[model samples]
Target: MGILQRAKPLSNIGAKQVGFTLIEMVTVILILGILVVGVSGFIIFGTRIFVESSSIDQVLSQSRFAVERMTRDIRNAVPNSVRLRTATGGSYQCIELLPIDSSTSYLELPIYPDDALVSGTVIDNGISINAGQYALVYPLASNSSGVNDVYQASRNKRFELQSSSSSANVLTLTFTGLAQFAEQSPIKRIYFASQPISYCFESPIGNSEVKLYRYADYGYIASQPAPSQMGTAVLMAENVSNNLLLEPAIKLTEQNLMRNAIVHIEPRFSVNGETFKYQHQVKVTNVP
Candidate 1:
């Protein structure tokens, strides 16, 4: 049959071929739209979760790294690598290297955290411990508050020593190499504020919780009454919302004459509808 004849026969048929009505089309479109919306929501939710998790993870890692640096330096806090001696409360904490063998040794001096008082540790790195002067304090502030460090601190004069008793105390003192000396300058004393480390940490609260602190004797104290223990500030993590810093009690153990104790810094933090835990132990000592 011709093409026109075939079409005419089909057109003459009583029943028409099946096809989708407007209702069916609309229903299908509606179902697809719903599915799309659900999938989009899921994708957005997942993306948010991932971002928050990543942020939290980064924060946790940073905390660990910073603490590690602290512990490493703290362990070496000795007469040579570090100088630890009794100081009047509220005095500055110092860190410096004395050249026993070389002509000019570098002392990093009083360690200061990068941040401010509200969110920093008091532990500083620049002041040098005049190990020779720990026993005596000059201009004695009497009690504990009077003792402090008067380290050689002139930005331009890095090699110069504080002249409180520099000439009178050192009879055969030599800067180039270790020499015999009778009297070392006494650590300066003040009635308040030992050079404490101002440290910061987050509380178990929201994302912005941050605890402000100045702690040298394991806990943050407004006034360090003891002339022995001092503190400094170390900045750990920035943008910490909750102040979760713990006031830890420390003491010299009889068994461990090094006066060592470990503190497990187990903290729980929440981010993006999830809770995470961080646990680590920090070792500290109680040395007057």
Candidate 2:
């Protein structure tokens, strides 16, 4: 009787031990595998979207920097001295500001876009700041050939370099200066107004544009991008394109200041194929 009772309990236990058969176990594992695959796929798709979105944002930010820098220079444009105007295109960006400095008796830029004319060299008209500090951006050059063949320059010293059209191809602007500022005088500097560009991204559609205006009665602590002689360029933007629109407006003042610089820049592309458009208006100023 005891043996029969033990066998009966054993049988019951054996029956209850059927948690899952080999086939059932295989089925459960297959189901779990499917779930895992679906979850992983979802994660990968989400990650891809996030990466692409981030890339688009980055492009916009970089382009805005380029625009801000350009506009800031335009606003702080050196008056009738080193003026920036919208000619037919970039070709005439630095036209006849006449002389390189406030002192008027040095050179003559007879044409719209002046050319720097040395006896044997010709440089096209571009922007000119101070005498020793000026930039002449010419049009696209053809191989060894240059853009235009004549320009204008001036200095505090009374000397004018001119050449005829026959020698015009040889005519160009060249510069050299000599100055000995007062030493041990706290390294003094001239007061010049500055209009710096401040950049920001507002929306996904347009990420590279900003508001442009002048900051007159303000001044920049010019430092160096190169050495102590080369001043640091307060950069507002980078990654810019041809949508380079400039709308100039002036407010009532003793000297008409460029109140704002309005610009519309195109968007940047991303790996995931997204595009955006941006319009920016920036304030420019040269302050004390």
Candidate 3:
């Protein structure tokens, strides 16, 4: 009877050890599927957010750098040298300026007396000047009494350095047109180390994929040219917005009076189906 009792308990335990039924197995599989789908969705969402944030950061950095570079250049432009141009229907688009590389005092007046006869001018001994460099000569003192007056309109004269005499501290200058300075005038030299720089928007195919270009070596004339020629276009920024009405514009104050320029830049970038925009207003003061 003991043996038979033990055998009956073992048989009951075996019956209780049955594997999972179809309903139970299907329920577990459904729960696993739900967890997998949820985890996958979270991963995808995180990746998308990371990508979008990176894109935004890249656009912001590029736009900020470009604006700051242009602002610095414009602020240091020579007095009364900032020129602005607009497209048809008064859309502001282009700006050109003469950049002042360095300024130094003239040791004395030119050895010669006549403007036409003078070919070389003397400056301070330490001033560094090179051949092919441009110079703007003006009076050091605003109230000085001489042939070279301090008035903004009358004093400044542009000349190209044909050669330099480092030992004698003289710059041999040549005039593109006529020499503007007389020989016995008190003057200072504002060297033009860089060529005339111009910033403008150019579209490759009728306003498609418009890009910002920086042109250099386009001749320097006091008056702004109509449809200014762009020489050696360098890409400043890409993927510029197409709205002509919202492009970069320059508002120049009376050059002879304030010598100020206000630059408005609204750069828009489209990245990963998202649009990013940056707007900056830079007030540039021309210091000759």
Candidate 4:
């Protein structure tokens, strides 16, 4: 009886050690499942945060670059050439400019005593004259009238070089779209060059998103009633903010023949249900 009692206790202990109860196994599996879920949630949260941060960085980089480029171009634009107007059927904003690329003195006056210098106006060969290059005639004479004479002289008188006479060291010029200038005796002391630049906002079809565009090589028109379609456009930035009355606003001032402008922009983007915004202001000072 004593031997049997000892063997029975040993057998019971071995049975307990051999396998877990159903309740114990279930508790262990539940604990493991909780741990796995916690780890997975943490990893997903971390990855989402990384993606959002990267998206914000990209938006900031693109906004900064676009704003800086526009600022630089405005600062270097021809005096009194900055103009802001509504575009896209008056729903969007556009900023037009005459960016002075280069300048040179006039070699000689049109054959002289000509009515509006119809065709054969001659310019100095020293100036780089490409076919279809826009040119402005700026007289050197100081106006006693105390008016902005240089700005007045160049306005509405922008022309294109029809051809260059390399043998004669002169460029033949043509007027653009009914632009005609009367004979001014002081034409000998004049400068000529090209300036063309513009910025616009475009809204795509079936979308609320807007894009900023830059236009270049747009020849001078009598007036830019519609500037968005004026030249070859390049996309500057996408997803521009339009929450304000004027998303991209411009204000120009002229004092003592010098021109200046204030440009304000707010760029916005969305990422994973979160919206980001960046505001920038740039002051542009122009040369006379």
TM-score of each: 0.42, 0.37, 0.68, 0.64
Ranking by TM-score: 3, 4, 1, 2
Where is the poorest 10-residue window by lDDT in model 3?
141-150
In terms of TM-score, which candidate is stronger, 3 or 4? 3
- What TM-score should be assigned to candidate 2? 0.37
Model 1: per-residue Cα lDDT over 42-156, one tens digit each? 9999998889879878776775665565556444332212222212221222222111211211111221231211110112223323322211111111124432222222111
Candidate 1 or 2, higher TM-score?
1
Against the hidden true structure, what lDDT does model 1 obtain? 0.33
| C-alpha positional error of residue 180 in candidate 4 after TM-score superposition, expressed in Å | 8.1
Best-first order by lDDT:
3, 4, 1, 2
Best by TM-score: 3
Give Cα-based local distance difference scores for all models: 0.33, 0.32, 0.59, 0.58
Candidate 1 local Cα displacement, residue 165, angstroms:
26
Q: Please provide, for model 4 over 64-116, each residue's C-alpha lDDT reduced to its tens digit, 9 standing for 90 to 100.
A: 78888888877666555666666544356677766666554455434324335
Candidate 3 local lDDT, 1-288, one digit each (tens): 355444443445436555899999999999999999999999999998998888778766776777788888887766546666667643336777667776665554333344443355555447666666766654232232422222233454555566555555554444444554532323344445546788876554354555677877766544454434554677777766655555543455533433345666666666667676666666655344
Q: Which candidate is the best by lDDT?
A: 3
lDDT of 2 by residue, 1-288 (tens): 355444443345436343778999999999999999999999999998888777767766655555555455445433222223333332111111122222111133322233333322232233233332332222111113321111111211112323223233232443343221111112111221112222221121255333222222122212101112222323333333323234222111222333322233333323345544455443333221
Collision pairs in model 4: none
